[model samples]
Target: MHVLSRTLIDLYDAAEDVAPNEYPAVVMAVMHRLISFDGALLGCGLDAMEHARIFHRSPLLPSDYAKVYRSDPLACRLRLGLRVPVTCECRRFYVARECAEVKRFYQRHRIARVLLFGDPPAGRLPRRWVALYRGVDAGFTRNERARMEEVWPHVSRGLTANRRRHLERHVARRAGAASALMNRSGMLEAQDTDFRALLAADRLDVADGVMPERVRQCWRAGSTYVGEHLQISLQECGEFIVCTAVPLGCAVKLTPAERIVANLFASGLNHRQISERLGVSQNTARSHIAHAYAKLDVHDKAALANTLALDPSRVKTGRTE
Candidate 1:
C-alpha cells in the first residue's frame, strides 16, 4: 500500500512535465507497475458512445483493431455505459458468431483476457478509459481488478493535470492576455478567471461555457476576430484550441487602410515605396500615415514603430522594400 501511494504521487508529479501526447504512455507505465498487463489502450471522449476516441495505445494493436473493437461484446457493453471497473474473460464474454471478427482479432493478437476502467464525464472533463489486455488464458484475479480500481482515479486526475498544465503554458506565452481551452465543438473545456472576465466585458453569454458564434466561426475558419473590446487569437493545440484574448485598446482606433500604411511604414518603407506597394499616390499614403500617427498618438515614424512593436498583431514586418 505504501509503495502504491508513492507510485501514484510520482505519477502525478510526472504529469506536470510530460507533453500531452506522452501522458498516456506515462500513465500506462505507472499502471504496469501496479498490475501486470500485456497491452494497454487509453482514450477520452464525450459521454456519448459514438464520440469515444482513442488517444494512445502501447505495443500498437493491428490496424484493423480500431474497426473490430467496436464490435467486441465487452467494448459494446462499455460503450453502453461503464460506471465501474470490470474484468472480462474473453472466451466467456464473446459471442460465438456475432463477434467473430473481434474474436479473431483477439486471437490474432494472442489476447485472452481484459480489464476495463472508466472515469465518467465531469464538468468540462471528458469521459476517459483505460483497458488492459492479457495474452494468457488465465482471467484477471479479483485482486488485480481491485488494484486497477484503486489506481483508476489517480490516472484520471493525472490526465486532467496534464491538460491543465498544457493550457497554462499557452496562457503564459502572452502576458496579460486571457486564455481558454475549447473543444472542437466550440464549448469551453476550461478557462481562467481572466478569460471569464474578458468574455463578460465583451457582453457574450459565457454562463453556458459556449463560445460566441462569431468566435466559433472564426475558429473554424482558422482566422482571428477583432471584437469591440478584445482581439481573439486561436491556436490549435492537439485536440483543443488555445484561445488568447487581449484588449484591443488603441490598436482598434486605426482604420484598415491606416493599419496597412502603418505596418508598411514600420517595415522601413518610405512614403514613395509605401504608395508604390499599395498602388496609392504618395499623398494618399502620407494621408493614411498621418491619420494612423494621430490615432495611435505617435508623432514620428520611429515612435510609430515603437508603438506598433508593443502590439505585434498590429504590425506586419519583414518587408525588403
Candidate 2:
C-alpha cells in the first residue's frame, strides 16, 4: 500500500485506543495529511450555538460559524471566489445567485469576513463543503489545485464513512444507555426531543456530572470554548465505552482479515469455507472465530448470533472517564 494510505490506517487504528473526546484530534491529523491547506478548523453540533457545548467547540474556529467566517481575510477572499470553487455551497448566495443577496445577508449580520464553509455530513448537508484562501498568487497552481481536488473525493469519502460510523456509535450508545437507565427506574429521564435532536448529530455529549477544575480551566483559557455543552460533571464516575451499531451483515470492530472471516461465518460457512475465503488453514479460521467471539464477549456462534441480534443502542460495553 502507499505510505500515506498505510499511515492513515495506522492513525485510525491508534484512534481506537484513546478517549472518545480525543477522536477530533486524530481526525484533524488525518485532515492535515490529506489536505495541503495552510490552516484548517473543525466544529460540530451547534455550528450556530454560542455556548460551549461538548460537540460545539471550535475545533478550529474562534466561535460559531458566523464569527470565524466574518473575521478571516483569507476566508473573505475565498468568499469572493478568487480561487475557490464558485459552485461550492460555502460561497453562499454570492455565487449561488450572483445577486447581492448573500452579501446583503452578511451585512445584516454585520459579519464582515464572510468566509465560511459548512457541509456537515452528520447534518442536513448532502456533501462536505470546502473553503480555501486563494494565496497572494491569486490562484492555486494547476498541479496544486489538481492534487487538492484529487484527494477531495477520497477525503470526502473518508469523512462520510467516519460520520456514518460516528452516528451509528452514538445511536448504539444512546439506546443502550436509555435502556439501562430505564430498567433501573427514573434516575435519568428520557432525553427531550430538543436534546435528542442535538445528540442525533453525533457531535453533542450531554451527560451530567461534575467537572474537574483542570478541565474547566482549560475551556476557559481557550479562544473558543464549547465544551460546557458536553455537560461533564464531577459527580459521575465510572468506565464508559464507545459503541457503534453494525448492520446485520456488517462486522463491528474487526480487522480486515477478521471481517472476511465474519462474512464467511455469517454466510453459513463452516471453518473450511472461511479458511478458503481468508486463504488460511481451517484451524486458523476456527481460531479467528474464537478470537472474534472473545472480542464480542460471546462463547459460541449461537451467542454471537444473539449478541448481534441486539441493537447497538441497546448494548453498552465500553466505558471511559
Candidate 3:
C-alpha cells in the first residue's frame, strides 16, 4: 500500500535502462534484491520450439537448456499445459527419478534448487519461459522467504489477470481493424487499382473518426452505464478517444433496466433528465445505478468502467461462476 521504496524506485528506473531485452535481467535483479537470492536464472521460451533465450544464469549453457528442453519435468508440464503455477524444491531425486537427461544435466551442474515455475499469460509466453530458478544460498531469512511464498499466489493471480487484460486489448484491436476491413472489402471488389487505394484510405479515415465517438459514448455513461468494456484510441485525437480501443472487463452483468440507465448516462443525461426521458422518478434513476453495481459485480463506477474497457470479450452470459 505504501509507495515503492527508494531502492525499488531506483531499480524501476534502472529497469528502463535496457529497452526491452533487459526485462528478465531487470526482473531477476529486482527480485534478487527483494528476496536476497544468490544467483537467478531466467530462461524465456520464444515462439515455442524456436528456441528459448537464456539469460542471468552463467556457465549454465544452451546445451543445459537443450537437455532440459527435451526432458525436464517442469518444462514438460509447461509445454503440455496452457498455464500453471508451481513452487517446488527439487533435489537430485527429482532429476534421477523423473528424467535421465535431467539427471545427467543435474549431475554435471550440481543442480539442486527450489524452482518457481510460471506460465506467462497466454500469448505472453514461449516468448517467456514457464520456469524461474533462484539459487538456494540467496540470503532470504526464513520469515522473509516464507512471506514471498505466501504472497506468490496473489501476485501470480494479479499478473495473470493483467496479462488477460492485455490479451483482450490486442484481440479487440485486431477485431476492430478486421471489422473495418470487412466493411470496405465489399466496395474494394469493383474498384480499379487507383480507386481501390482511395477507397481504402477513405475507410481508414472514417473508422479512425468513428472510434472516438464510441469512446466518448462509453466514458459519458458514468454510473448508470457501467463501462465494463470499451475501445478507446491511444493516439492524439483532439476529437477522437485515444489511438486504440481498450477492452475493460467487468466484474458483473447489468439488467435490462440498468442497461437503459447506463445508455442514458453515457448520453450525458442528468438524473432529472434521465427520469423524464425514461418516465421514471429521480429515485428510480438512482436506484438503477445502485442495482447496476450489484448486477455488474463492481464496487464503484470507475472500477466498473475500467473492468469493462479492459476486458471486451466478456459478454454477460450466465452467472460469473
Candidate 4:
C-alpha cells in the first residue's frame, strides 16, 4: 500500500504529460513503473474479436489477438466473454503447448504469464483493455496481482482524466465554445474555465450541483437549447455527459440606434428600404447596418438573422455600437 501510494502519484504525474494519441503509452508506462512487467498491450475494441485502437502494446503481441484469445484457457472458462473486473492470469488462458499457434507465439516472446484487464464501453466511450506480460523466469505472484487490484481504481481515474483532456481539446477547436461533463441529474462533474465563466455570467444556476430547470429542459429536449445570451449542446460520451456552451448574446447590448438598424435588417429590410423607412440617406443606412453588425459580432446577414432568432428581449437594451 505504501509503495502503491507513491506509484499512484507517479501515475497521475505521467497522466499530465499524456496526449490523446499517446494515452495508451502513458498508461503502459505507469503500469510498468508500478508492476515492473516486461512489456504490455493496451487498446480499444468492440469485442475480443473486434480490435480497434491499440493504446500501448508490446511488439510481442500476436498478429491475431482474437484467435489467440479464443484459444486461451481462462478466456475459454469465461466463454470468451467480458464480465466486470476483467483481470485474468496467464495460466488460466494458456499453460504452454495447449494450442500450437498460441504456444509458438508465447515461446517466441519468452512469455510465461499474461495479466489482462478489460474495460467495457460506456455510452459513447468505447471498450478498452490492457495486458501485461512477463517472461518464463518470473511469472506474476498473488501479492503482485493484489497490488494491481488495489491500484485499479486509480488506474481508471487517471485514464478518464486523460480521455477528458482529449475530449476538451476536441471541443476547444470550435470557436467561442466551452464544454463540461455533467451527470444525468444535472450534477456538475467537471468543466473548463470557459464554461464556468459562461455559467457565472448567465441567469442559469447550479444549485446543489444541479442545473437550472430551463437549461436542463433545453439540454433534454433536443440535445441543444438556445437562451438569450447563450446556446448549449449536449451529447452522451460513454456514461459521461458532455455539454458545450457558446456565448452569442454579448452582441445584444447594441445601442438604441444600432438595435433599431439590426432589427430592421432582421425584418428583411434592405439598406435602401430601411433608409426610406427611417428617413435617413442610403449611405447613412449602410453605415448603421455596418455598425450594428460589428456590435452584434456577426460577419454577415445569415449570422445576424440567427442572432435575431433568439428572443430580442434577452439582451440588455443600451450600449455604444
Candidate 5:
C-alpha cells in the first residue's frame, strides 16, 4: 500500500479512540499529513435551520462564536445549496480559489492553498464540508486531490459511522431506544429485547427472526430511514451491523406560532408556501419551522412529517430559502 493509503487505513481503524467533539482534529491531522495544510475548518449538519456545529483550527479566530460563525461565507454557500444538488454537492474535490466566496475568505485569512471535500453519496446523512488551508502562494495540486479522492470513501464511512453512533444515542435518550443487528441479507441476526417492543408498538413484527419487510426495504434504500411512525439510523460498528431505532414521539413542544408552522409543514408545504398560507414572511416561516423542528427533535421536513404522522410526499419541491 502507498504510505498515504496506509495512513488512511490506520486513521479509520483507530476512529473509535477519538471522541466525537475531538474527532475533527484527528480528521484535520490526516488531511494535513496528506496535503500539507496550515489550518482547517470542519462543518457538520449544514441546514437552513442552522443546526450546525463548526470546528476550526485556524489562526487568530475570534473568541465569540457569533462573531466568527454568524454570516459565515462558507456556511451560507453550503446551506444555500441544500436542495440544489449541482452546486451543493462537490465532486469529491474542490479548490477554494474556484469559488468567489471561498477566494475572499481565504484572502481575508491569508490562506493560499485550499481544498474542501464533501461527504460521499452513500452516507446520505448530514452535509459535511472539510476545509484545509495553506498560508503560502502554492495551491492544492491535482495529485493531492487525486489522493484525497482515493481515501475519501473510507473516511466518509468511518467519520459518519462514528458520528452517527454518538449522536443517535442522544436521540435515543429523548425517545424510545431500540437496536438490532442485521446480516448482509438484512436479516435480523440479533436484536435487543427493547428492539422487539419498539417495533411491536407500531404493529411491525420480526418475521422468522428477520427484520420486517418495511425495514428491509428501508435498509435497501440507504443507511438511514424513517418509517411511517419510527425513524431508524444505521451504521457499521466494527463487525456489528448496528441500527438505532427511535420511536416517533409527537411530544412536540412548540409555541403557537410554531404550531401554525408545523400544521402548514405537516400539510406538505415548503417554507415559501407555508409563509403564503400563514400570511407571514419567508424568514418568519423558516424561523417558526426551525423552532418546531428543534422542539420536536427532528432534522428535516421529511423527518418532521414522519414523526408528526404527516405525509411528506405531498410536499411540493420548493426550496426552503
Candidate 6:
C-alpha cells in the first residue's frame, strides 16, 4: 500500500514537469514499479474505439506497430469500447484467423501478455486507454492487476493534467491570440474559447474536433497560412502542434522587403541606417518605406509602429537603430 501511494505521488509530480511527448514514457516507467511489463501503449479517442488513435508506444515495439494495430481484430474490439480493465495472454486470446497479423506482430516482438485499462469519457475529456505488455511466459498475478486498476485513474489524471499544462503554457506565451493544441494527426487536443470563436467566426468547419484540411496542411509543412479571414501560424511542441490565429490585418499586404524596411523605419532607423543594415541603397530603402506606408495607410513612424504591432505575422524583435 505504501509503495502504491508513493508511486502515484511520483507519477503526478513527474507529470507536472514533463513535456506531453515525454509523459507516456514516464507513465510506463512508473507502471513498471507496480506491474512487470516489457512495453506499453497509450492512446485516446472520442466516443468509440474505431476513432481511437495511438499517441505513444513503447520503444520495444517496432516503428510500424501503430500502423499494424489499426487493422488488428483487437483494435476492432477497442473500437467498440473498453468498459473495464482486462488481462489477456496474446497466444490464447488471439487464436482467430482475423488476429493473425497482430499475432505475428506480437510474436516478432516477443510480447506474450497484455493488461488493458480504459478511462471512459467524462464531461470534456475524451476516452483514454493504456495497455501494458509483458514478454515472459507467466501471466500477470491478480494482485498486479488490482494494482493496475488502482493506479489507472492516477495515470489518466496525469495525462489530462500534463496536456492542460502544455496548452496553458502556450496560450500564456501567445497572449491575446486565439490558439489550440493538436496532435500530429490533426486532432484537436485542447483549444482556448477564443480559438473556437475564431473558427466559428471564420466559418471554418471543425467538424468532429478535427482541424480543417488547410490548417492541417500548414501544420504538416510547419508554415503559416494567411487567408482572407484569418492568419494561422504553426509552432511545433514536441509530439503536438500549437496553432495561433488572428483576424486578417492590412499589414499582410506589404511585400517582404517593404515589411522589413517598414519595421526598421518604425524602430527609429533613418533611411541611411536602414540602407546600410540591409545592404540596399538609401533610395531603395526609402522606396520600400513609401510603398509600406501606402499599403498600411500609415503616414508616420508612430502609426507604422502601431500597425506593425497589430500585425499577426510580425516578428517582434529588440532590434534598434
lDDT of 4 by residue, 1-321 (tens): 576677788778766776644655666666776676776665444233433233334433534655576665544433343443344334444554367766666666666677665643332233345667776556666666666666655776777676567566556456667787664556554566577668666677653345567877876776576665677788766544678887755344565666776777777889888777777788887887788777666899888877767743544322233
- Alpha-carbon runs more than 4 Å astray in model 1: 46-63, 122-124, 173-177, 181-222, 225-232, 236-241, 245-321
| Superposition TM-score, candidate 6 onto the true structure | 0.66
Q: Using TM-score as the measure, which candidate wins?
A: 6
Once all C-alphas are superposed, what RMSD does model 3 give against the true structure? 19.1
Alpha-carbon runs more than 4 Å astray in model 5: 48-104, 120-123, 164-176, 179-321
Model 6: how far is 144 from its true place, Å? 3.2
RMSD of each: 9.1, 19.6, 19.1, 11.8, 18.6, 8.6
- TM-scores of the candidates in the order shown: 0.60, 0.32, 0.37, 0.46, 0.43, 0.66
User: Cα deviation of 316 in candidate 5 (Å)?
Assistant: 48
TM accuracy, model 2 = 0.32
User: Where does candidate 2 stray beyond 4 Å?
Assistant: 1-4, 45-61, 64-139, 142-321
lDDT, candidates in the order shown: 0.74, 0.40, 0.43, 0.62, 0.58, 0.75
lDDT of 5 by residue, 1-321 (tens): 888877877677657666555666677667667776666655444331222233344434323222444454445555454222111212222243255443444456665555666653333444455656566766667777776666665666666655555544433343357776654445453455577778776677774455666766766676566655577777665433566787654442455577667767876778888777667899998888888787676898778777666433222333234
Model 1 residue 11 CA deviation (Å) reads 1.2
lDDT of 4 at 120: 35
Candidate 5 local distance difference test against the native = 0.58
**How badly does each model clash, as a count of residue pairs?**
0, 23, 34, 7, 0, 2
* Candidate 2 structure quality by residue, lDDT tens digits, 1-321: 875677467555644454434554565555455443443333332222222112222232333345544443434444343333322222433545444544453444333222234433333322233443322223334554554544444444454444344433444343222211110111121222344333333343334311223433443453221231222121111222122211222244455566556545754679876666556899887877777676665677776656555534233212112
lDDT of 3 by residue, 1-321 (tens): 332354355444554343333444555554554454444444334222323334444554455657465666666665554343444455544644657666665546544454444444454212233244545523324554454444333333333333333333333444433221111111110111232222233233332212223333444552221234332333321211122322323333566667667545544567898787777899988888777666556786676555445655444322111
Number of clashes in model 3? Answer: 34
Least lDDT summed over 10 consecutive residues: which range in candidate 1?
46-55
